[model samples]
Target: MAIDELLDEHEQSERVREWLRRNGSALILGIALGLAAIGGWQWWQRHQANQQSQAAGDYQAAVDAIQANDKSAAGKVQALPEGIFRTLAQLELAKSQVKASQNEAAIGTLRAIRTSDQALTAIVNERLARVLIDAKQADAALKLVATGDSLATLEVRGDAQLALGQREQARDSYNKALLKAEVGTPQRRLLELKLTEAGGTPPKTESQS
Candidate 1:
């Protein structure tokens, strides 16, 4: 190699080293940040998984306690974190309270539950309206159920209307509920009875037909 070519190569190598020296700290910092971000994401995923697992276990325990009619079930349900499981637990607790003739408590229990799911909210509203009716808050119950056309909602609305002495409206609501409630089911039979009590005729049964 010529002397000039060797000197040019050496200069190129020195330039490359100088560039590295100038930017090495920035490159190292970027790599460190990237690794930290990955580790943080992994930690978050694990934390979420652990939370879900714990929630599942707590929910199952609450269910078992409720089914056994344990008096402490309400506390367990109340202690549940806000989520689907907690909403479901609150529902079970409300039902138990209702069965124990604690209508006021059931109303409170049902009211405390909140969810973003429209369908689940409708179910909760139906249950809450029923308790409202039992508590003689028929006006509130009617208002709560007035917007829903579901069979359960209609039936509860009918009950509320009946409580408010709106027999004709009750009859209409019961008929609406009966239209959606399948024949031969207990729900259909109950709605049919309610329709009759509201001075409306129910559809003929198979035996009657």
Candidate 2:
């Protein structure tokens, strides 16, 4: 090689070595941090999987306890960490309480359910409203269902209206609910009965109209 070319090569090599000497620690730290992050993420995923499994097992145990008529079933359900399973368990507990003529307790349990899930919220509200109505707190039932437009909520609102002697409001609520309930379903059948009780005629089907 020419002397100038060799000198340029040597200069380039020295510059690279100097740069490495300056940045070697930072590069190594960056790689270490990257590896640590990966390891932490893997550990988190495993921990989450384990927690989900435990929650599932606890929920199943609660269900079994409830089915066996164990008095401690509610406590078992209540012990579940908050999640979908806990919310469902609370629903089951509320159902059992309502069946056992524990309307007040059922209301309390239903009210305690906290979730960001829209569907679960509707279900909880419907159940809570029904329990409130059964407890002769129709006003509270109506208030609980006031902002909800789901089929279940509307039906329960109608029941609450009927309880409050607001036949016209009950008829309107049931009519709105009937619009959403599918034909030939038990829900539609129940709405029809409720409509009749409120002296409201079912709207004509499309074919009839």
Candidate 3:
């Protein structure tokens, strides 16, 4: 009986060894594939980090150029990747252009900042409208600021409407601007003056909660 049991154990061991010999290569291949997948993911993460770092450096350089009042500030900004930083750089460049009496160039620069962000779009539109108004393109300015809700945007719209001799629309826009502006602030005072110009009275200030 002892000899029979030893033979049985030996048979079972041989069967296990045979199974491993048949399947070992497949198991090794699966482990290799998993390791390759992990390596690929790590490489992608590193690549993305490097790209972001480079973009940040380029954006900072453009900002520094603008601050230094470099004549090439716009060129530096134009070379940046399309993003918020690029949009801000363009705005700074447009301001510089306006200061240099380059109204047409400033209008073109401001119009180029077409970001998908709502806040950024609003800011760009407000700036573009102001430039248009300055250029005596009141119709274009009115179209740009027509849907805006902010105090500054409303003021620009009012300015445009007034320029077009649309006194009633200008009065409504100035009133809206006054409502959005902070009480006792210079902006509110200006809005009040505009409202008066449009033949409307300023509303009494309410406490902001």
Highest-TM-score candidate: 2
Clashes (backbone N, CA, C under 3 Å), per candidate, total 0, 0, 0
Taken over the whole model, the C-alpha lDDT of each candidate is 0.93, 0.92, 0.88
The regions of model 1 sitting more than 4 angstroms off are 1-16, 204-209
Each candidate: RMSD? 2.9, 1.7, 3.4
Q: Is candidate 1 or candidate 3 better by lDDT?
A: 1
- Say what the RMSD of model 1 is: 2.9
Q: For candidate 2, lDDT tens digit of each residue in 1-209?
A: 89999999999999999999999999999999999999999999999999999999999999888878798998998899988999999998889889989898898899989999988898898899899998999999899898778888899999999999999999999999999999878889889999999999987776557
> Mind giving the per-residue lDDT tens digits that candidate 3 earns over 1-209?
69989999999999989988999899899999999999999999999899889988988898888788887788899999898879988988888778888889999999888699999888888888888888999999899888968888889999999999999999999987877787888988888888888888887766533
Counting only residues 3 or more apart in sequence or on different chains, how many pairs clash (N, Cα, C under 3 Å) in candidate 1? 0
TM-score-superior candidate, 1 or 3: 1
- Where model 3 places Cα greater than 4 Å from the true spot, the runs are 1-23, 206-209
TM-score, ranked from best to worst: 2, 1, 3
Q: Local error of candidate 1 at 62, Å?
A: 2.4
Give me the candidate number with maximum lDDT: 1
Each model's TM-score? 0.85, 0.92, 0.84
Model 2 steric clash pairs: none
User: Any residue pairs clashing in model 1, and if so which?
Assistant: none
What is the alpha-carbon lDDT for the whole of candidate 3?
Answer: 0.88
